[model samples]
Target: MALIPVDAALERVLEGINPLPAEEIPLHDGMGRVLASPLHALRTQPPFNASAMDGYAVRASDTLDERRDLSVIGEAAAGARFPGSMGQGQAVRIFTGAPVPDGADAVLIQENAESVSDRTIRAAKPVEHGRHIRQAGMDFHAGDLLLEQGRRLDPGALTLAASSGHARLLVHRRPRVAVLATGNELVNPGETTGQDSIVASNSYGIAAIAKEEGAEIIDLGIASDNDQHLSSLFAKARDTAADILVTLGGASVGKHDLVRGALAEAGMELSFWKVAMRPGKPLISGRMGAMHVLGLPGNPVSSLVCAELFLRPLVAHMQGARHEPDMRSAALGAPLRANDERQDYIRAVVRHTAEGMIATPFTRQDSSQLTAYATANCLIIRKPHAPAANTGDDCRILMLHR
Candidate 1:
């Protein structure tokens, strides 16, 4: 099959995808969850015209003259509103958040009012109408859509939901991702191994990336290069009802690459198996029943780049949240050679200077080098068949998590 452009490949992966079914969860547990329905305010904020600061509530006309003394009436504290009304020459002692008494149009802040006697307070400053008062529905009104559908509930959003009288929220379910690694030479971290054995590291990075995007990970561990091992892991992933089955390594057409055959046998309808990208060219996209499948290359950098480019969006879209990478313009720190047909995501160290963002691509961009990927803070996007550029040339960069 011909290599597919990166954008076309991603389009294929996300075609016809919709958010998962919604489930109601407590508002306290709503952080990072996507809203399934529009959140409307249950009641008007402030409920009534209330004092914005500790002050004396009075009729605006009564306190307009700083020389005039107003008679003090009943006090109105928060949660204990003054039931009676206030009229000309009447001032109610009100604290912050207290409901302004009826007929009172303004609050003379305590700093601007002086106590003349036990029953009288004099205005030190002219009290204007509506001054220091929070009117009803100032923040939000009942039936107002405060949060739209598919909005991610961040710290502020959760607080807003609570303030809007939402004890619970309807949110899209978190995407479930099952990760499986393949190869006879692969061993788990911290495990004893002989010659020719290499510790498997891609799954950890992949799982971390998925989790950062609010995905629940089910680690299928390492599968040796054999049909039986690969097929059994595939079954486990299906039995676990994973939303996306991510297989590491074994995505290419090499002799030991068995993941493709196993997934195809397990009823996976293959979408494509190659992308026109340098580090992550052997990427795969498919689906089995309702579960999506992605086969990533074995190289460490390749797997992570693919995860950022493809898997992150897949997980985010599944939960009705947007997780696109942060892309921005920058100046090249050094000269770069012409790019090949495949798009290149060069790991680079980015710096902030008087000249704005400066991204310097690492000299070595081997797919197996995890050290470079870890230390780099951004990826310089070098388009396919591009000509050489100098140090000061403008370039585009994708900011990494670091």
Candidate 2:
């Protein structure tokens, strides 16, 4: 079968992907969660007109004259209120955040005043009405939308919600992913490997990626190439109520590659397979009822690349995040060879240069090398049928870190 282009494959996988239903959660547990409903201000901010300076609050007209000096009628500190109203030539010593006196219209900062006595002060500058005064609901008003749906909660959001009188938030529940690694020759990393068997490592990396995208993981330990074992694992995945199922390896034509078949037997509607991407051509995606199933290639590097290119977005979108690969343009540090019919994601090291960004590919481009993938900070994307590139050639690179 001919391989599908990268964009088309991505479009297929992302079509109709949206966050699940929302749920109400306590404020303490809402950090890093996506909002499912709009957050509204329940009360006005700075509930009353307040002072913004630790000085005197006086009627603006009281200081209109050139040599206006005023007597302090009363004092108002934070958490204290001045009872009497102020008239011309009368002032209130008010601290920051204290409610402004009824007749006071402005504040003369301490730096702009000279204390004549315990109950009097001389103004060094003219005061303006509403100056240094915070009006009621200045930050937010009751019934105003404070945060929209799909907004990710950060520290600032938390503070805003708290100030807006919200003790809890309605947020999307974190999706759960069931990760299963399939193959007869794969063993657990902690177990001693035989001459012909290798440790199953792709699931660990993919699991971490899913969790980082805010999805909880249910690792369905390594399953050998057996029909019964594969069937049982799928059943367990369903029982765990996973929102997504990721199967590592056994997604290709090999006799022992039974992931696709097992999923189809379990009623999965195959979406697509064989994307036109080097090292990850055999990747497959499908859906079983409401659950998404992703078939990742057997090669460690291929599995990771597929996860970044595909799985990350699926999981992020499931939680209503605008997810996309972190791609940026860069200049080549060295000459690169031509690409085949598939788009090549060449593992590379990115560096800052006097001219601009530069990416140099690793010496070996083997699909099985996990060390190279780990060492690479970027992937130089080469389009299908693209010719060789020379030093300083412009190219698009996917940054591993933001």
Candidate 3:
């Protein structure tokens, strides 16, 4: 197959993808979950006219006269209302959030009133009608649209939903991803290693990226090059009902690359094999039964770069969200040589300077150098067949960190 460009490959990876089914979960558990539908207020806020401050609920006309001392008929506190209405020359001692009594349209704040005698007080200052009162449904009314569909529940959103009388929320199900690492030369971390054996570190990074993108990760451990071992893990992924199965490494056509063969035999339809991008060209995009398959390169840096470009967007798309990477322009801090058919994602450190944003790429960009990838905060994108760029040339960059 011809090598697909990065943009084309990403488009193919996301084509035909729809949001996962919605599930009803408790409101408190909705943080970071996308709402599946428009959220409506179940009940009106401040269902009745309530006092906003500690004061006396009285007729507005009665407080206009400074000479008159109104008799305090009764007291009203939160969760309690004065049963009797206040007539002329009468006031109800009302606390904050207490319901305003009948025949009362204003609250004379305690600071604006003074006790003339027992059970009697005088308004020191006049209060207008509806002053210091929260009218019914002022904040929101029942059946009012509180949140739109596809809104992510943040702290503010969650609180707003709760205050709107929603004990449970309908949210898109968090995508469950099963991650499997495959290779014969790989060993579990902290285990005994031979001269040629390396630690299996890609799965942890993949899992972290997946989780940060709102996915539930299932670690399938490490799969050897053998077909039966790989098949068992694939079966586990199917049995677990994972929405996406991410296989690390064994995607290339090399002699020892066995994942593709086993997955093909197990009925995974291939979408694409290679992308025209540096470090992450041997990417496998496919589907097996009900699960999406992404075969990432084994090199740590390449694996993470691919995850950032592909996995994050896929996860967001599955949650009914639009994934737009943070792309910005920066001046090159040093000269760069180019002219290659494959697109390059040169890791670099971006700094804000008096001149402007400056991006200085690391010297060595080997696929196996995870340290450089970890240290860099941005990826300077170089288009295919681009010419050499001099220092201070404005270039586009994808920010890895906000």
Q: Report how far residue 266 has shifted in candidate 2, in Å.
A: 2.4
Residue 212 CA displacement from its true place in model 2, Å: 2.0
Superposition error at 236 for model 2 (Å)? 0.2
lDDT value, candidate 2, whole model: 0.89
Clashing pairs in 1: none
TM-score of 3: 0.87
Off by over 4 Å in 2: 64-66
Q: Estimate each model's TM-score.
A: 0.97, 0.91, 0.87
Per-residue lDDT tens digits of candidate 1, residues 202-275?
99999999998889999999999988888888889989999999999999988988888888888999999889
- Candidate 2's residue-wise lDDT over 98-211, tens digit each? 999998899988888878888888888887989999999999899999898888888999999999899989988898999999888988988989999998989899998888
| Tens digits of lDDT, candidate 3, 313-335 | 99989998778899999999888
Considering only N, C-alpha and C atoms within 3 Å, which residue pairs clash in candidate 2?
none
User: Could you list the CA RMSD of all candidates, in the order they appear?
Assistant: 1.4, 2.3, 2.9
lDDT of each: 0.92, 0.89, 0.93
Q: How many clashes (backbone atoms < 3 Å, residues ≥3 apart in a chain or on different chains) does model 3 have?
A: 0
